[model samples]
Target chain A: MKTHLQNGQVIDDSVPQGDNEAVAGKVVSGSVIHIQNLRKEYASVAGVVPVLHGLNMEVMPGEFVAIMGASGSGKSTLMNILGCLDIATSGSYFLKGRDVTALDRDSLAHLRNDLIGFVFQGFNLLPRASLLDNVALPLVYSKVSREERVVRASDMLSKVGLAKYRDSRPNQISGGQQQRVAIARALVNRPKLLLADEPTGNLDSHTSHEIMNLFKELNERDGITIVLITHEVEVAAYAHRLVRLADGHIVYDGSSHIPQGDNEGTMSKNSTESSAAAHSTS
Target chain B: MISAMLNEAWNSMWANRLRTILTMLGMVIGVSAVIVMQAVGQGAQQQVRESIESMGSNLLMVLSGSSTSGGGVRFGAGGIPTLTIGDAESIGELPLIAGAAPTVNETAQVIYGARNWSTQITGTAPSYFTVRNWDIAEGAPFTDSDLRSVTRVSILGKTVVDNLFGDENPVGKTIRIKNSPYIVLGVLSAKGQSLMGRDQDDVILIPITTAQRKLASSQVVGSVRFIMVQVRSAEVMSKAEQSIVDLLRQRHRIREGANNDFTVSNLTAMANTAAETTAVMSLMLGIIASISLLVGGIGIMNIMLVSVTERTREIGIRMAIGARGRDIMLQFLLEAIIISIFGCLIGVILGIGGALAANGVTGIRVEITLSSILLAFTVAAAVGVFFGWYPARQAARLRPIDALRFQ
Candidate 1:
């Protein structure tokens, strides 16, 4: 497979899946993210249920991708494993050239502390703390001094356009503003990977667009690698690349119709469904 | 990081003002109760010591027994006159005996100039001053010559002088006791209340011979009411007492297996008994006060458990933000300690105020010692740590996913 890099999108003729996918060109991008045959299971009362069945996917540096799936698609499980909130039951998962599957809980915490920034769906913030303090929460775990943590947290809050509301608590602000504070907190540590598990899951459609626009600006300007998980197609429409999952496996991995201005592989049911969709659209 | 944790803990406390104050109220009541109760015990102990000290030096009283016997029936301890002046003189010669005085007291009407007062007239030798560790403020005590020659001379106590001779020097004055003219030789120094709550300075001192000759109506010439003995050394006080008993037994012809004819009472034994009683009283008070502290500690535990349950989502958010298990534990623990420390401060102020109030209202001494305050403070802090542990551990051990999922 060979990839041609446009200004802000990765358009590869052959999509990469796992470490063995041979990619020619700068699409490899220093092998920043590599996952091979990753699997996760949950022991429900009925029996041991496999959530992610030998899923394989890879992400290059500075790419803004969205993983879209319906309920029970295991997209959330894959996002958890990739964010180091959980470990894969089998196979290796790597980020920035380090195998995260073998790391202990403390080491994984350290990785999450310095490397990954997570934004949750509920805008999970300490309700009693000010916006600035909420943003500075993640930096408290770092070696940064108090003054620097404050300064950097303020800077991130400003970036999220909530600088004026820095002194207000989460309950005092609007839902969109609180979500912005959550985003500021996620970015305060200057992490390498920004992971959002439904960042606009609770916001109105217009406010969700505003949040998605902010994510787009952050990706374009800062070149920060981002992987967002959402079930909504309109929310996923803002990403440069789209990877769809179904029954714990990748059904489609290609550039979204927005960047490439192509309808190809947009909502492919399967490989056969992609052919059928191409014919039907023609 | 620790300061950050404290900051968060402080914020949580302020957010729930009523709960925080209620928790602290328990500690305040507990710590202050312990302190005030201990202060009362300490004050009581000081009063006991002072009361024992007012009696005299390490003294032993040998009172004549069988004085209460009537019709061949002995009633009580002081039933008969077993001590005599000759026995006192012999006991004085013993190496263990520092001093001995044969004392006989009688109530008499004293007249000086135009004023007259009824008072006690105690007859003894000059060695009575040494035995009771008394000093003459103006003139001399009646001497052995005055005792042997039966001189009609007297030394008035400060209280007797004040009563009979109002501000006038009673030394070398003439006072008639029971219509007998006796010259006042000197005025004795002032002594405070005795252990029996009588004024020690309310009597006149005169020669034993004079009293045996003129004043008291008695058939026995050499027999005295009691003998006051001072030990040469405090270490051999018991030895001195045993030797005096042996001498008295042989002198009175008290047979073996017979009851003692006299009662020997030492200040050391009296003081020890009073101290034991006070200690038992203090222990009982402390146990009762500590029950309040136990209830207070339980109150802390109950509230802390509620706080942990209420803040489960907060704990999850903190953990997701990179807080370790230790950090969560420290946050809750710090919150509890801060509450206890503030409560301790208020309790110390309240306890000291209570002690002062007790002193002011009841006119009873209430000594608030620093050691008791320190002990109460330490116990309060320990209560915080002890009662806070289980809830804090529960907070730390919570799984982040489950906590976040909880409503």
Candidate 2:
């Protein structure tokens, strides 16, 4: 029998357990997200191609979740849905105890603006605006007063160790510093969920380690739930929980405290259908 | 919120200063053209009005014949000698007649102190000066006794005095006209030029009785060139003109529909025609100049499209920050408005400066009215809203995902 992990407990894979009750029963309050049977498809010239097939996931407040998959494993599509940038084909998504699937585009945008902060792989800062202005951008949509916006933005920049460079533009800073600014911008609105897609994708390994450490620190001290997508094991090593997707289904969802060498073996065995994931990670 | 949008718009424009300036130039030139055209038109009309006003508003001229030239071979209104002094005296007796002058214009060579000059010599009663809105600058005008006695007294115009007497006063001096010595009575004030381009001050005034009896013997004794009549009141001018025409036709024994032997032209009618024509011409020029503003608006639209495409990534960034479509639209719309308002301000300065320069350089009259400036500015703002909406809409419609992925 396959030994699968649920809520940090080893269970038999033959049990056919419903994961929603297991996660919801564990954390009664502060349940940030609850999704069941989430399916996503794209209309291709050939036909409708499914990317996520009946995916079920649950994330409690303040938990750092790292989602790992190779290029065709639908990791980016999953991040898009979780960030409210997209909708699923047919599924129920309750974010912060509100039915997100029933919301319209504008309401979804409002929810995204209010409850989620997005960090892209590219550190997409408006090139012409100063770091202070960039960090205050989300508050502009929220109609925050100028004095409050500046104060809150400056406070976030100080947390990222970029307070001195608030007046400087994005291009004037280094790549690592730009990502730090992006992080500051993400946290300026005090979003409950921080969604970062390969936040350190363009950085060197040393800088990526520094950035991931910052994520861990923020998750621990501030109790901010973070979900990051990455294809690199080293980048994913920072998260407490690891969820691996293969062929549009979750192959493994467990604590990532297992040895690194053991992960290579499990990847090769579990994602045999997608040899790309095993080879890319190894 | 608006302040935030404005600040963003200002920063984006500052990023491409040269392109912004180039775009502004189109509207500047457009608005300036409109103002200059309107100024010149208004100035020309004002000049026409001043000239017409100097001719005495209620005055009427009784020419010897109709204005239409027979068979299209044009003849001056004074070509026929059909009017007589009797016609003038009868017109003067009417209830509406304030005064009458039978004027005869003939060029004469005058000599004074070996300096001789040829100028127009007008012979009429003293009322001619009043009817023509002329004030005597030196000695008094010749009286009716001077007209009946066929006296050799003459009133010299300012130009004639300047040329003939230089700085000296010629009131008591003698000037020779056709070798007949005449005493200078008064010097007329400068009247500049008439609407017909005739020099009003380059002439002399003498009695009509003397002109008929002394200068040209071939001219009949009873006939005069034309009759200048000033109506007692403006309200009675049309009635005055009608009664005079009827009396003239009766004296000349003309039957009904038999084309009267004379024409009566009133100053108000002539002034209205000239003023209307000038106003219409100005409106036409104003309309033509405004077309350039439309072209400027198109220029704004074209440049904004390029800006929208160039800043696709920025649009995506803003959208990701939870900006609604209207927010993106407002940013661009504000940008276009700033350009338009800036363009209008510069154009107004240039337009007023150009009008003044035109007055100095080309000597063309140009009036800069407050209303035209306001009108031009309002139109420029409207142009901003009109041309700006499309490009702003295009930006607003962009999907955040697609825009971020754009290179």
Candidate 3:
């Protein structure tokens, strides 16, 4: 299947075109993420539970994409693989043209630090650290000098308009402000890709829009590639393209403006019934 | 990276002030216990060593053998008058022997004008001072002429001088012993206490001839109680002892395979045994204190494990933000080390203070050596690393997904 971008670019999943160097499993040069035949599984007492089955996708540089899925749809698993937080059981996943599956644990960590930034749903700031230190946390692992780390982290904090609260801890701020701090931290290292997993899940609708607007501004103004995960249609509406997952498969992959009632109806119905079943069994 | 981790560790510890201090309490108690116990034990050992040195080096005591009475009742060693001034003189001439003094001691009442005290009176030649390493603090010791002329001259110990003279200089003053007036020749310096806990300074010395003729007139002439012999050095102590034994046996005309009339005892050997016992006691105290250090280490491990579990979410967040396993491990490990080292610092201060207080209150000698402080620090640091390893590894080995999922 071919997924077309708003900027007149096409992501062909079948065969990558020119600049695809086949030197020892190297892929097309310009794609930020290129995954082919990706699969993941967990071994349980009963049997093997497969979460992703030979999923193929590509994300070009500077594109904003949102992944939407019901509960148990394996979207979280795919996001984890893209973020380099987990290794696929069997797959050829190249992040920034380097085969991620072939890298060791430390090398993968370096790649994540250099290439991708993560914003979790919980706005996971180190509660004990000041906001400046929280934003500077990634640079600590990146071997940045202390002076430079503070400079860069404060610059990012000011960009997110939380400059005055640099010395404030996470608990001292409101929920929207905390998410803004999380965004500041995510952008501090100048990573090429921002992988936000349900970044606004904990906020009310008004605050969620504020955080979503911050993500949109970071994507458009700084040209940072963003792949956000969420089940909320309004949150996904900000992204130019959408990938919807159902039962470990991408049921719809197209423009985000497609009527949500038809797509979300089956997804939300499946989630509600499954949740009801889970509740009754428990 | 290390500095940043240290800062992070410090912040976390500061955030959990109560828990950090509670964790450090174990190490503090352990290190202080080690220091105080070592001080006390080393102080005891030093006291034993000083007492040993004060008795004179390489000394041997030759005591007269026990005597069997009419009904086969045996008197103990040194009960008979077999060791005499003649035997002591002959022993002094031996090649390995440094000097020998025939000594006879008895309790007697000493009287000065308006003051009188009962004290031990030792009768011996002037060589007794050199043989026993007794120094004269003031005036001059009596000479050989005094011994030969049977002069009624005496040397007073510090304790005796304090009692009889008060503030007066006893030298050239007359003191009455058994109603006979004797001129005080000199005063001996202070010798604190003997190994047997006897007051070495509470004595008076008189000429052996004067003592034999005037004081103990009922005894045989030239007979003495025991002979104090000094060897040249520690190396020839056994040789000198054997030579004295053989010479005494031959002099007393004891037959082959028969016990001699006198027994030679090595004082150095007895001192060595006492020193060894104290050394063993010191070592035992150190070991006992080290057990508390072991408990402290275990306490660190226990608290670290709990910390790792509690901070799993933080570890997950750090890992998500590109922290490697080693980074997480180092963070936790640094926290443990900081706690222990700070605890050690406080413990050293408290231990030294406690040792000084013990010395002040109990009047015990306490030594707080630099080596012991260094030892406590190193052990505390080593304990921190050793116990922190497993919990740190447990935190590091956590999967990012699993850790993030931990509540």
lDDT digits (tens) for residues B316-349 of candidate 1: 7777767767778888988888988898899889
Docking quality (DockQ) of candidate 3:
0.71
Q: Which lDDT value does model 1 have at A94?
A: 76
Model 2 spans with C-alpha error above 4 angstroms: A1-29, A36-54, A88-90, A101-109, A246-252, A257-282, B66-76, B95-100, B110-118, B133-141, B153-191, B229-242, B255-259
- Between candidates 1 and 2, the lDDT winner: 2
Clashes of each: 6, 0, 0
User: lDDT per model, in order?
Assistant: 0.80, 0.84, 0.85
Q: Residues B217-319, candidate 2, lDDT per residue (tens digit)?
A: 5667768889999998888989999999899989999888677668888977887788899999999988888998888889899989999999888888777
Question: Which residue pairs clash in candidate 2?
Answer: none
Order candidates by DockQ, high to low.
Answer: 3, 2, 1
Docking verdict class for candidate 3: medium
Quote the lDDT for B135 in model 2.
91
Task: Highest TM-score: give the candidate number.
Answer: 3
Ranking by TM-score: 3, 2, 1
Candidates 1 and 2: which is better by DockQ? 2
* Residue B324 CA displacement from its true place in model 3, Å: 1.8
